[model samples]
Target: MSIATISTFVTAALVLVGIALALLVGTVGVAAYQFFSQNRRVRVARREPLVGYYRTLAFG
Candidate 1:
């Protein structure tokens, strides 16, 4: 094949690989954010009960 043809093929392949990598990273980032946010919400929900119990014990 000619040099120009080879160069075009290589460039196209690199662009496709870069796009795939970017999508994978974006997906992983979104999943991680969702996992952490859900964990934080659960922790916060559980804390309210513990705080109320501590207050009752301290006052009464």
Candidate 2:
């Protein structure tokens, strides 16, 4: 009922929300990277130049 108590509750809620957002974003990013990498690999396998280019960029 007090302002101080309400402020504390709001702070805790905001922190939890922030943490949840970070986790969701991180998961989405990882999933996107994997999907793109797989697609790139598939394309590379279907072509020689792309595969070579990817390899050169990765290791050379």
Candidate 3:
């Protein structure tokens, strides 16, 4: 095969590899964000203390 033909094939393969890597990194970033956000919400909920009995429970 001619050198030019081989170079073209290599370039195409590299481009495809770059696109696949970008997609993989993007997916991982999105998943990490969701996981961290949910964890933060759970921590916040756990820290909140109950105020007291509800109005109906109070004799008044």
Candidate 4:
């Protein structure tokens, strides 16, 4: 292949790889955020110190 064709192919490959990496990272970040938020909410919902009582059971 010519130099121009090789260069174009390399450039396209790099761009696609970069985009794929960005998407994967973004998806992971969002999933992590959601998990933490849900954990926080559950903690808040079940914050009562009393054990074996209705509040603890409700939180769980």
Model 2 ranges off by over 4 Å: 45-60
lDDT ranking from best candidate downward: 2, 1, 4, 3
Q: Distance (Å) between predicted and true CA of 53, model 1?
A: 22
In candidate 1, stretches whose alpha carbon ends up further than 4 angstroms from where it belongs are: 44-60
Clashing residue pairs in candidate 2 are none
Alpha-carbon RMSD, each predicted model: 10.2, 5.9, 12.3, 7.3
In model 4, state the lDDT of residue 1: 92
Error of 3 at 51 (Å): 29
Per-residue error at 60 for model 3, in Å? 46
Clash number for candidate 1: 0
lDDT-superior candidate, 2 or 3: 2
- State residue 10's C-alpha deviation in candidate 1, in Å: 0.5
> For model 4, where is the 10-residue window of minimal lDDT?
48-57
Question: Model 2 misses residue 5 by how many Å?
Answer: 0.5
**How many residue pairs collide in each prediction?**
0, 0, 0, 0
Candidate 4 Cα outliers beyond 4 Å, as residue runs: 44-60
lDDT of 3 by residue, 6-51 (tens): 9999999999999999999999999988866666555566664223
